[model samples]
Target: MLTILPPSFTLTDDSLQELLLSSSSSSKSWSAREEACYLIFFSGTLPVLPGSHTASIAGQKEEEEEEEEEAQGDPLSESQLTSLKEGLWCPDCRAALLAVLSIFSPGSLAATTASSTSTSTSTTTGAASAVEARALLLQVSREQWKDRTDGGHVYRKRYDVQSVPTVLKWIGGKEVGRLVDEECADVDKIRALVQG
Candidate 1:
């Protein structure tokens, strides 16, 4: 499981171009398993629409109608709203990733081997369990990937990232599943894909 933590930013074409440039030189040595998984961490925001007109009464009426339709539609539940605010609503992408890692035990192996091989340089004091190892993996991955760039931008032309709190899952560089916008925010969906 190799997670690509792209600089945190909204999706945009320019941002995608930047990502292409920046990641071009990075190592792509990670191997793919039958259960290989890649998590794309990004700021989920709706794509900006091009073209605009002066505000008019007709436009205002349209806006009101849309709002009315939304109101009539199914609204987000309390937990969903809280998840959105906490940035955890993207199908619990982070949690799902962690769950998958826990099942695979790669992070656990890496952490244990590193700690046991070099006690003098080891940051952890005692033997770490798989869960702890997974946490360390996430922490280290974030720290390593976070400061590489300023941030990301929303580029809808390539990745259809429609909102800020989105999580995309890929296998062998092909998108197998995703949680974007207000679709099913269940991590089970991601788990199922990973399990497959």
Candidate 2:
């Protein structure tokens, strides 16, 4: 329900400069641009209003739910839906993609983010993980995420990312440590993620 971003084509518009005052932080500007990307995926949608009870979702997740039959997109098998739960809230595919977007802070790493192009185009590719991460999140509703045939399955196999909100500490290209799920939400654990 938050689709307020202007089209990406407007991102470079010279006329829009009038909206910025000198004190505005560049970070805020970047964050604004990023919102446009969130719109590209429907991850910005709130299934039920925030701070309310969680509801079941049916289609196009990074996602929310109600009325599985009324949910948009193709239906997932019970077994398949169960598999997706590890990485997504309610195992919605849309959540899978949103999880990836949540991974690193802007400029936090000299990182490569594999981004799928818009439909009917070639998805961005480079690092094996980039492409893998993109595919996993983009096609949550289209395939069995943990199945051998799913590319995300392959990516997770390499990193051992079995669930959502996993934080990996990669030092010099080798994984030094990791914090999974609830551990990531703890203040002390987050400090330890970098310190211990």
Q: Which candidate number would show the highest TM-score if scored against the true structure?
A: 1
How many backbone overlaps does candidate 2 show? 5
lDDT of each: 0.33, 0.30
- Candidate 2 structure, TM-score to reference: 0.30
Write candidate 1's Cα lDDT for 116-140 as tens digits: 3332333321322222110001111
Model 1 misplaced regions, further than 4 Å: 1-35, 40-155
Against the true structure, candidate 1 has what lDDT? Answer: 0.33
Taking all chains together, each candidate's TM-score versus the true structure is: 0.31, 0.30
Q: Each candidate: how many clashes? A: 14, 5
TM-score between candidate 1 and the true structure = 0.31
Query: Taking the tens digit of each residue's C-alpha lDDT, what string does model 2 give over 84-118?
Result: 34533333333332223222111111222223211
What candidate 2 gets wrong by more than 4 Å, as runs, is: 1-144, 148-152
Model 1 lDDT-worst window of ten: 46-55
Deviation in angstroms for 62 in model 2?
A: 22
